[model samples]
Target: MSLNEWFERGISKEEYIDSLQKHRDNFLHIYENFSVPTSDSLSNKENIRTIVLAEEWCGHCMLNIPILLRLTEQANIPIRFLPRDENLELMDQYTVDGKRYIPIVIFIDQEGNEVAKWGPMAPEVKELVEKLKVNVPTKDSPDYEGAFRQYVKEIVDVFRHDAAYWNYVYEDMIKSLP
Candidate 1:
């Protein structure tokens, strides 16, 4: 089946929005006061299909999907969703170092050839992740678990209140699309 059919078979759009609205207050802040684009180049967006592969419970996915839902809705873009876990065969193709990552969006033309793909995060935030990764204890370390949890918490906290940070992300996302 096509990806759109797969998406419709999986989750209703309303359910997706409801899930987004229920995100933790901190993560929810990423969408607050986001200025939805009032105009977009129609010719550039025409006949493009966007598929968002994500997990409902992921904090990053929670922070990003609402903004996508709003902006794409306004732009009249035909976007769909697929759960990463449910599409392992397809999902495996997108892994980084053999580990699956959520919120990876695949963009395609009308004939289904890929145009461009963008996800994970914008450049600046990715730099932060790299910096944070360096401080995490290795698996062989006795303090691995605590250190890892602390790192995860720090990333989540960054996503919570970083409005200027998210602006760069949103702008990059819009620019990356076909």
Candidate 2:
């Protein structure tokens, strides 16, 4: 199926958010609080639309999806949400280093041609996450699983409370939008 077809099959913003099994509060917080910076660049682009590949339980999605929602809402850009797991066929097209990543936002024009894309995490946020990951135990260690789970929790906490990270996402996303 075409990107447009996949987008059509995706859920509405409300439906996606309402159906989230985790990170609902974090999603709502970002959705309610993020302020889209004024962008003269997007002002005249009426045909732009976004297809978000995301999952409810993804920490990155919990942080970035709502910001995307607010940004698109303010910019008057229509957006759709596709579950990454169910949409792997499409998601695979946006992989990095052969790994599928969630919260990938594809910007398309009225003709269904992709203009730009942004995803996963902003560079600064990626750096921060990497720094956090340095503390995790090696995979061969007996405590590796527990340490990794703790690392995941810490990452989520950062995503939840860091406005700087949110701003980084907005900056990166805006730079990629046509």
Each candidate structure's TM-score, on Cα atoms with residue i matched to residue i, is 0.80, 0.94
Best by TM-score: 2
lDDT of 2 at 34: 83
Candidate 2 lDDT score at position 132:
89
- lDDT tens readout by residue for model 2, 59-119: 8999898888878887888888898898889999999889997789998888788999998
Worst 10 residues of 1 by lDDT: 3-12
lDDT of 1 at 175: 80
lDDT of each: 0.71, 0.86
Clashes found in each candidate (C-alpha, N, C closer than 3 A): 0, 0
Tell me, by lDDT, which candidate is best.
Answer: 2
Model 1 agreement with the true structure over 133-166: per-residue lDDT tens digits: 8988789999999999899888877777666666
Q: Given candidate 2, what's the lDDT at residue 174?
A: 84
Give residue 36's error in model 1 in angstroms.
3.0
